[model samples]
Each structure stands twice: as C-alpha cells, then as structure tokens.
Target: MVVTVGLARLCRSVGRTASSLSVPHQAAAAGLPARTRFISTTPASNLQFKLDERTAHSSLDLFKKNTGIIYRMLGLDPSHVQNNPERFRDWAVVLGDERISGGRHYWEVTVKKSQEFRLGVADAQMSRHDCVGTCNTSWVFGYAQRKWFAMTNNKMVPVTLVGRPERVGLLLDYDAGLLSLVDIEKRQIAHAVKAQFKAPLCPAFGLWDGELLTHSGLEEPEGLK
Candidate 1:
C-alpha cells in the first residue's frame, strides 16, 4: 500500500514599496504605504513506489543468500540461526520492487529499531552477493555503534550527526545525479553525495540486526529543496 504524505510546507512573502519614494519628494506626493503579502501553499506530491510484498515466495527467494533474515509485511528482521555461518555475516541486502531511471524520488526509513542498518539505492542488476555501498553500483548511509557513515565503492566516510535519528529520509535526484540522506525529526541533511549514475536504480537496504520499516510516496523535505 502507498501512503501519501506531505513532507514540506512552503511559505513565501512578496513586498512592494513605492519606488518613487526614493526619488526625492515623490514619497510625500505618492502617499503610498508599503505592503507585504504572504502566501502559503501545500507541497506538491512526488513520485512514489511500492515495496514488494514479503509474502511472495519469489521475493523471499531473491535474498536466499541472506540467511537468518525474515521478511515481514512492512519490514524485515534478522533471526539468529544455528549452524548458519553466513548468518548476518554477509550483507543482507533487499531491493524495492520499483525501478527508477529518471526524475526525483524521495522515501523514508525507520531505523530506530536497528542498531546496525544500511539505507540507500543500488543498481537494479547489481550483484546480490555484494553489500550495498561496498560496490560501485550502490551508495548508502549507515548507522552502527552510535556512529553514522556514508559509503560507496569500498570507500567509507564518517558523518557527524547532532543526535541519533529515529527516522531517516532519502532523496534521489536522477537528473542532478545526487543522493541525500536526511534526518527527519531534525530537518537536516545527515549526508549527501554526487555521482554519475549509469543504471536504473532501486531502493536498497542492508539489515544486520533488528528490523527496518520503509515509507515511500513522500514529498521532498523543504530544507533539502
């Protein structure tokens, strides 16, 4: 199901003053007062995509390599499994069902429950065996051990945040070749990067523990605009 929500509220102000006033005695002659008008409008809706149903056997099979991971209706969780050496060792990456080629798209992920999780986008055909952000096809912002970071092409950069964020936002502008990670409650950008994306992309995730819930079909946050 797609949930429609407005993430931005914009207000603009227009002002008009008698320009003649600055032209010497024209101010007294015009006898006009300065006026200001404020306008408020609802944010426009952005492109939205749906997450593939977890109940689908085919969908679950796509991540078979990611053992010990359980897919739920709205989220995914990792269950400790015995004798599973690969359990949470390799990246448990999941891709959204939608394929985005162009235009700007925005979404949010709830990471409060996951102590270690990855959020970002990956090329649709990227190897499932490769971890998100570790390969050239994906870019991701992650949180672990009370620290946050962004990674791509095996390179990781530490990002400083004011505090831990419960909900994180992702904005992908295909035309601009930009990907930004936002801290929802703080209305601030946690990290962002620019790239020459070459392939159709999908929202991707890597969950090592706990669970992650995603929110799509959201308007871009005003601060980022």
Candidate 2:
C-alpha cells in the first residue's frame, strides 16, 4: 500500500505531542546471548528484510484513541506513548493503513531490554481494551515480568529461549497459517505458531512505558535484488 500523507497531515492525524521518546526498559536477561532450543524450518534469519517505511501508513483511524493510547511520529518514526505509571495498562498503535491478506510480509522491530512490550499482528476487529496477546483476535510475542510469552486466547505460553533480543523480526504468512518471530541479532527463530486467521490482519504493537518502537524500514538485501 502507498501512504501519501505528508508530515504536516500526519501530525494533525495523531495530535502531535511534546513527550520525548522513551528508552526501552532494561530487562533482567538484558546481556545474555540469544538462544533458541527449538529448530526452525524457515531460512536462516534474513537480517536484511525489514518493513519498508515508505510503505508504512498510520492506521490511527483503525485504533480507539479515546483511552489515552497516544500516537506520534516525525516522518516514519512512529512511537506509542503513555507517560504515567499504571500497572497492566498498555497502549498500542498499528502500522500501515491497509489490511494484509494472503501473502508473505516481514518487519523488524528494535526494542530495549524492557520486559513489557509486544510485537505481532492483530485482526482488524481486535478489542481496543484487550492487550495484544491477551485475546483471541491477536497473536503477540511479548515479554513481561522477566519472562517471554506468546499469548493467544488470553493464555500465556512461555517461550523458552536464552537471553533477550534487541532486534526481533516478525514474519507473517497468511495463506500458510504461520506467524514467526526471529531474533535478528542471533539469526535464529525465537518462536512460531500456526493459526487459521478469520479476518484481515494489521501490524500491531503494544507498549506500557515510554519505550520507542522504531519501524526499521529494511528491505530484502542486495543478494535478493
């Protein structure tokens, strides 16, 4: 999808804020090496494949913003904001204005060691009050309270992997019924799940702190070109 909104128009859309971008939380396993005990069937991590920022569009209209889930962006650098300290309270914003169906798509998200952020895709009808990964409409890989999780149907499934990933890549295959998360730094697959999607999916994010979630506009590497 082509997103033509200029910087000025985008600011009006999200009601630009003065809050400084927050740093990622320091995780307990912050410095450990990335380790995945389960083997992956996909190609070795493709560090070069990132969502093209030029193709990114703010799906702000698709989100429910009345609940204090703030959205801000300077050019393509978009971040979710929530300044006050509140437990179990999370805010999310989706990327790309259009819904995706029946194809392979990937994006790399860089996050701090904080144990409270989520990266994944959610059905367009996902509940605004439901934190990503805590409901059936979403499939998210997240970290909370020093543990890694892949939540679906409001159930927390612990993902056993050594250390933490600074840059994680998400790959969605609609037809294949697969959602995969890769540890980009380690060139390894962190986790994968199979699901029969019922509706169009959007790239969604969840954050509890002021942590910045940069949409690294990476494309297939030169060799693929």
Best by lDDT: 1
lDDT tens readout by residue for model 1, 156-186: 5666753575777888777667787777887
User: For residues 2-27, could you state the per-residue lDDT of candidate 2 as single tens digits?
Assistant: 12123221111222221111111122
Off by over 4 Å in 1: 1-45, 53-90
User: How displaced is residue 99 in candidate 2, in Å?
Assistant: 1.3
lDDT (Cα, 0-100) at 149 in candidate 2: 64
TM-score of 2: 0.56
C-alpha RMSD values across all candidates: 20.1, 16.3
In candidate 1, the residue pairs with backbone N, CA or C atoms under 3 Å apart (3 or more residues apart, or in different chains) clash, namely none
Worst 10 residues of 2 by lDDT: 20-29
